[model samples]
Target chain A: MAKPACKNLEEIFRTPHGAVYQCNRANCFWLEFAGGISAFKASDFLHLKKQVEQIDVPEMVQNTARMADIVILNPFRSERCFVLTVTDVLNLRELLQGAKVMLDLNSMLYDCLHAMAV
Target chain B: MKDLLRLRTSLTEEIETLLNEQIKVEAHSSSVYLAMSSWCNRNGFDNSADYFQKQSGEEREHMLKLFGFINDMGGRAISPEVTNIPQEFESFRAVFETALQQEIYVTQQFNRIADRCFKAKDFMSFQFIQWFLKEQIEEEYIARRALELFDVIGEEGTGRWEIDKQVPKIKYEN
Candidate 1:
């Protein structure tokens, strides 16, 4: 018989990014790291560092910052993976204000989520 | 039993048609946003085009939402047949005004669908339409606000750049 499906969010996080996976059941999480492993690692690390700094920095940094919720786990052997869930895109806008950023990662993340919903 | 079966069949057909029409509307909305994006690009409004491109994605999301709903209900969602979208606009104001009109039309369409579901005693479908009804209100409000901003800038001719600068600040929520 086929193995029982992984249904929990933590079980879903076990699969590494960039691997083809599917969660066919309702209320299950499916992580699709469309980009290759290196890119996913870099983005995930950057987001984690940003989240950590936002949470720990001084009041000056805290005053103009918002951090997205992130879950990090060792999915595959020695491969650290992270997923960021943003409830409010507006909070990101407040965080990025007056900063000279090249690409809008917040918008990209929002689009990625929207694509998944579709 | 025969009469009840006929009534059920008729109700199913009607609901199917309405659902298909909604799919077409969503597709048409995507095309409309694409057209608006192209117009903005040609008119040196890159930020506006970006906004419309995001709007196009949202429209696709709307189509998929309806598609999932229909499939979940054991109903077939027909492929949408979208008309050619006009790519030219006289001004930004005109574009937004047209968008506002389309949102109003879509709200009316949703209301009609809700009414039909009520008549058919399909409370589930009627309840599902409530989300779209609420969304339409915000959609119209945004378009109307854009129109009002256009009027304000057009009247003064001084704040156009400022308004254009603000375009990039618009937020897109998933």
Candidate 2:
């Protein structure tokens, strides 16, 4: 039996700054970051991961401009925005990378279990 | 928990990415054909210009087919941004040579996509791409035949004009 509060949400990965959860009922991922929770569809989540990974940390570090110290992301189909600093970006990257690895592992497990069932 | 990812999309990430890449390839091919059409028209090869226009339209149709299929399967279809289209050609024969090369590249891309679909066990996409694979036979055939026109009719005096006139007649029966 699942916990009552988390009946629909499954924790995929966690870090000190943030964590990733999947809502099986909604078929979306719930991102706990920046003192808020944003829900993203699976494909949107992958796109967001790509956007974050594409951030150039070295450029941000080298540039003396204040704006260069951070990056902004407006996720698709969402009103919420992420304004992340270089440190924040690194943390988020770690969180997302962990979640992606967990997701891949889950997919492999699902395939194996289904193959056995078949 | 239920597999939310699989529930959200029928396409695996790898397959989805590959399909999007193919979409870009098709769009780029369409743009290149359109540029070829323009070059032919500027060079006064009217028949070859029309042929390339028709080919461009067909390539756009192919792009749309892949785009529709991706969306139908609950995957995102990206509208590709095409660049680096050549605006000029060296000579009349060079145009047909480039066209044939483009067709061959497109066939190779479709073959790669089919191979990926097979490996992923996504038989639906594999079956869908079979139409493209078969269409490639006609595409490559027509392009090859048009290029052969330059060889059959030497490009010395009125040879280019004759080749341009016969370009529209090149057909693939099978």
TM-score winner among the candidates?
2
Tell how far residue B141 is off in model 2, in angstroms.
1.9
Docking class of 1: incorrect
Best by DockQ: 2
Residue-level lDDT of model 1, residues A1-118, one tens digit each, is 1223454212212222222222233322222342323212222322332443344224433354444243233433225444433322223223222110212233345547779999
Question: Cα deviation in Å at residue B89, candidate 1?
Answer: 1.1
Regions of model 1 farther than 4 Å from truth: A1-118, B1-11, B155-158, B168-174
Model 2 root mean square deviation, Cα atoms: 2.8
Model 1, residue B154: distance off in Å is 3.2
- Per-residue lDDT over B66-86 for candidate 1, one digit per residue giving the tens place of the 0 to 100 score: 898876775556678888788
lDDT of 2 by residue, B118-166 (tens): 9988899999999999999999999999988888998989999999999
DockQ of each: 0.01, 0.59
DockQ of 1: 0.01
